[model samples]
Target chain A: MDAVLSIRDLAVEFKTDTGLTRALVDVGFDVPRGEVTAIVGESGSGKSVTANCIMRLIQPPGRIVAGTIEFAPERALSSEGQAPRAPRLRAPPFDIVSLPNRDPRLQELHGGLISMVFQEPMTALSPVYTVGNQVAEAILCHRDVSRRQAWRESAEMLERVGLDDIERRMRMYPFEFSGGMRQRVVIAMALVCHPEVLICDEPTTALDVTIQAEILTLIKDLQRDLGNSVIFITHDLGVVAQIADQVVVMYQGRVLEIGTVRQVLKDPVHPYTRGLLAAIPGLAPKGQPLATIGSVVGDADIETPHPLRRLADGRQVSMPQDSRG
Target chain B: MRSYLVSRVLGMVPTLAVISVIIFTVIQLPEGDIVSSTLDRLQAQGVDVTEEYVQNLRAQYNLDKPLVLQYFYWAGNFLTGDMGYSYLFSRPVNELVWERLGYTLSITVSALFFTWIVALPIGIYSAVRQYSIGDYVMTSIALVGLATPPFLLALIFMHIGFEWFGVSTGGLFSPEFEDAAWSWARFADLLAHLWLPMIIVGMGSAAFTMRILRANLLDELNKPYVVTARAKGVPPAKLVLKYPVRIAINPFISNIGLMLPGLVSGEALVSLVMGLPTIGPLLLQSLLNQDMFLAGSLLMWLAILTVVGILLSDLLLAWVDPRIRFE
Candidate 1:
């Protein structure tokens, strides 16, 4: 399978008042064409940071110390005899990290070929603009569509996100909607441009369980229909099990384990990955006194004095690195 | 909305009451009698002090009553729109105040427009090119304006204009203005005299506005939506102008409340220096002579202007920020 997106030895650091603090180190992953890849880790495990690096959203202090983030545009063209469908990434095509801050190529790909759905829907949108205006703005930014055409496209995209009464809702502000509706609006905004890759950084984490399920289902359905690669970052193991086809387990900003979801979940490797599995409750033997993994992967303090339970499994869960995944 | 308006209107009652109390108390605080002072001053000028003149003046003005009764009488007259005659000017207080109010408002309104039009673009540019030479230069100039007193700046500019451009430190309009019709040339000449004083007053206030706008713009620049706009491939210029000027300027509408009251009240100092026949200069002269009717009425106009200015700013803020819904 061709790599739809490739990141190699990605590292990020922050120049703080104290000194250089390494935020992410030697992190690399690939999203194969038309597949969902989950970057699983606890918060502050550099999952979202890596995703932000792809979008160039990382700002002052936190800098991409070293890496190569390449997204091949030519991959949209197939070499096979079959009709030239949208070519997916075959290999590393262009280095995103090394690109000039204001490169036209990066600008062309930002909302055109790539889009992102942030964690908090409330903050991700401009409170002053109507949903329809924001979505239409996204469309008109890349496409040569008239404002009227853009509005029509925005309504259609809202409808595609399962929002009923798209016409009326588009005229409403984000505050006028519920949390789920706002998330759908954000999803619609991201998908409006038909991006090649949708980098969702904890998109469903802020939602309730039922809404999370609904959003995950919507994302999966959209990915299948649009034939776009998905890079879903999450700390929830159950969510990873449900939506991720491939999983890259990260610890301390480093890739701890990378495999098909079945291989990683069913037959886990890597000590950190095994610990993550052991910490989750429902996955253990019924009524057998749940096994707890000992040792924190990131900044978690597992051994700190807490009510100790000597479980039969003899495994203790430590504090995870950063809680911001 | 009606309830809100009613509440506002009702709230003004207490405010006006407090103002009346303060005005009455302040006017009555002198040790010597008003008649005695007036008589002494006239006698010093070699005019005969007459008991009949003083008693008649007191009875006609109804000033012989107790202070509270005098206050009530004036308040009642004010409520009935009978502002009474000015003892000093020998004209109706309302007519005198209203006429001077136009001149005060003309200078203030023109200066306000000048401040906004000049400061907004400068503020935005300073913020956008922050840490660059342009930012440094603008900041330095703003600091000078902030530190220097307006009167001093007025003096310096007047001296320079007088020497270099042969500009005279005349009143607001040319001496020939009364003879000439209200033509554009006459208006232009009026503006030319008004410009220096306006700058002296406006620049003193506008430095703070520039600093505020720059800070506000920088804060808005850090917002996530601004980043999102950039990622949408919006050009740098459009991104800076759109978000900073359009969305971030909501806070600035509130600043109008402060500027309006200051411009209206502060007109006295600058007008005195410039010899402009504005309300500030007139009010000051009246206050010195204990010209109660003219001074009190003019101060009331200032109070009304301040309230209206605040209300206008709130309305403008609601219009600018879509998130603020009246309903």
Candidate 2:
């Protein structure tokens, strides 16, 4: 499959009062074009950091030490050197790392070609602004439309995100909405620009299971209609099973395995991957203790609070240092 | 909205009444009655002052009554536009305050305006470009402003004005415009000497507000929504103003209450040093002399202003923060 975003030797570190903690080290992956690529990891395993780095949203004290995120354009631009507003046209491939923050190419890609839907939609929106204003802001950021037109288009997008009372929802603040509604508004804000790639950072983690399923369905539906690629990050294996076409399992900031959903789930290659599969609740036999990976194989000198839980099963699975399988 | 306003405004009545009683009682706390003090002053001035005269004045002014009844009499006269009298000024307290009100207002307003205008951008910049050289300089200057006494600053500026410029910057206007009508020259003259007191009065508030705004904005900048906005390709400037700043300015809105009361009452020491003809000095003098009606009335008016300030701030908060659905 043709890849839209190919990351190479992606390294990230966080500077703290104590010392530098490796957040992402030698991590790499290729997101197939027009497919949902889910990056799965436990908290503090750098799943969110990878997404933030792609958006260049990593603040000071946390830096992308080394990496190249190359986004491949699906099609060519017209002779005018101008991007077509229609989703039919493809954006040129972007070097997300090397480009200056103020670069027009980056601005064009961000919110226009690349957008992110964050976890905790409650805090992901400014409470002072009406949902319409925020959506309009996203549209007006890239598109050369009048404020009224942006509002009109944004309201349409809000309706597209499955919000029933579009007019009322648009006028209300984020604080006024239910968790589901706010998440939908966030999705609307991200998708309003018709971004080619939507990076969802645990978008459904903060919600209930039912809401999570609905959001997952909405994302799938939007992807089907819009034909944009998605990079969904979450620790929930169940969600990955339902939505993802390809899965990337991460352990302590390193990619353990990458393959199709059936390949990874039916026959997981990495020991950590198999452990994750075993850790899934309600799947194990009713009588026996659930299987779990106890400890890592190698990495003794690299000392810190390890992200993966040490299980009572006592079995350990570590990355084979020589192989890149 | 109407209910919010009505509740806030009506709530002031009880507050003001409580303040009025407190101010009157406190003013009366100084040793000896106002009548005996009057006679003592007369005796010191070489008049044949007598006990009978003191007793007559005390009975006449109803100073012989209980403290609560005295407060009622004073409040009644006050409500009727007679702010009793300023014994020190040999004039009615209303006349004294009204005569000086405009001068005090100009100085206070100018100081407040300068404080906000200067502090806001500097605070924002320091927060945005935190750890940069300009931010460091601004922070250091803010510290200086916070630490240095305003009166000392007033004195320094006054001395420099007289010594270096050979022009005294003590009063709000030159001798020519002391009693001049509203002319461009008098206005310009007032503006000329306005800087010293404005700086003295404004410096601490500017520094304090800067620190608050910087901390507030820094906090908002770290929020996930700000990241969402930035990811939305919201330009740096608009992203800040549209999202983070709007959210950050919540507690800052309440500061309007703090600013409003200070704008009218004036900073007492700074006013004394600059000799800017503001009410701070007059009110202080009245309080010191135990001029009960004058001091009580001034304090009561300030309390009323404070309550109005709080109400106005509450209204502004409701307007800015949509989450505040006032019942």
Candidate 3:
């Protein structure tokens, strides 16, 4: 249970015309080293917000009200199993929440130690620049490499992402590539610097179903090769089952369940988790109408605290007394 | 790219031909050719208006020809650089147009550079700092510049030149250099007089382009690609200039075509108000007096400028944006 990144009691508030409204409240999770942690919930359930919080990319009008995201990667050996460099000392674990937005360390951490892949691949890359120029730009930003060297590395990374004809593809723009191919370029850009943590915010949500599976496989393969921690945000439970090692089920900005994939999927303690698992189309009985959860998760109840209780099987569940069986 | 350019240039021939026909027809659509206007002036002085004199005037000017034949004669002459005679200016149309073209282009080209140079950075600032006090102030000034007519601004500039700067009002030269040859001193005088018109003419267009760029940059700032660049640890300034500003400038580049014709003819009112020696005033006076060859040639020149400007802009747009280039 070597956690690479730990977020504790993270809360986010967004300013609206009415007043301030909470987007995330008392959410906590751990991304274990070299493993995938899936944040699964419906839209507006703060799944992406939690991922954004970890990346420190919460835009204006939404501020982190309370939180501490502690990132502590191992210092002895790099994630790629290479010998640690003796010249540049490794930085100690620090709270990302406390670093100012303009701090050099925070800027260095972005795309250097932690990187992100956004949802829409169609618009993730600039239209005016070539794929090689963009990927090389990322490398140039983080590393002390010459433009020619960066371009060469970019070509190799593009080939590594399963793109054919790396030389021709490097000269092409994002619009020239298909959606799936564009997603591969985006993944190459995110992984070019070999960051210790990669935050994928619905990386396959906008792709075709088959392309989605391919992208998922590409990400999983890249993660395994890089041996880095991944915070995978997705709404599809099937994707969770296929790729995630740990699952954190969130409902309306509140974490209702958190455990290993086997523990949470086979034995979901929270009623919302059970409801979600029951709603899966493939898991339903043949020719029968999909089962619907009768009880509604009240928005008002989120304000009052409901402490998470640990179960015998080592899964954590927030069981509000009124909804408990 | 070479083939595209050749095809685009070839495409302009038919377009210009069609536009030339429209310009000739529209000029003729107004009642009374140049002969009638001359006759009316002579008649006002109590000269006998004979039918033979009218026929002779018509015959001399080729006014008796059919409309289609007249178009062929004018079009043929125009293509060969023989722009016919201007009855109003009492000189060849080409001489009148060419002499004024140097002055007209100097004013318009400098004004265009002034507009872009002043507008671009301010536009980027206003958009990036959206509701900040500086943005609000710039936006307010831009609105004022947009609302105020160029002619009125020219007058105000003249007044300020007279009252505060003690500089002579109107024209691109002082009274001493009005008819003098292009000596260094006369050129210096021209440069001094040039700023007033450039600032006055460019202010309105600069305001318009700035607001457009601001709106465009605002839209581009929120796009996913911008966020992607920011996530790549690109500093805020470089991120903005490299990603969003580059895309936002496409509209600004596309505007070059429309701005060419506008800078030429749109200077008419301001030229008249300022009494500058540009083609705008000549074009206006020619159209008013129904001087057929003069007005026709001038209108034809405007049409040519517009078509050529559009071609230039399309080519530049392709160079700036890869999406349009391949398409």
For this target, which candidate reaches the highest TM-score against the unseen true structure?
A: 3
Candidate 1, A244-312: lDDT as tens digits: 888887766767667788877887645567789878877556677755565424534432322212222
Model 2 regions more than 4 Å off: A75-80, A83-91, A283-287, A295-325, B49-56, B64-66, B259-266
Return whichever of 1 and 3 wins on TM-score: 3
Index of the highest-lDDT prediction: 3
Using alpha carbons, what is the TM-score of model 2? 0.92
* TM-score versus the correct structure, for each prediction: 0.86, 0.92, 0.93
In model 1, what lDDT does residue B76 have?
90
Ranking, DockQ, top scorer first: 2, 3, 1
User: How well does candidate 1 reproduce the true complex, by DockQ?
Assistant: 0.43
TM-score of 3: 0.93
Error of 1 at B194 (Å): 2.1
Pick by DockQ: 2 or 3, better one:
2
Q: How would you order the candidates by TM-score, starting with the best?
A: 3, 2, 1
Tens-digit lDDT string for candidate 3 (B99-161): 677777788778889999999999999999999999999999999999999999988888887
Clash count for candidate 3 is: 0
Candidate 1 chain B weakest ten by summed lDDT: B28-37
Winner on DockQ (1 vs 3): 3
Stronger candidate by lDDT (1 vs 2): 2
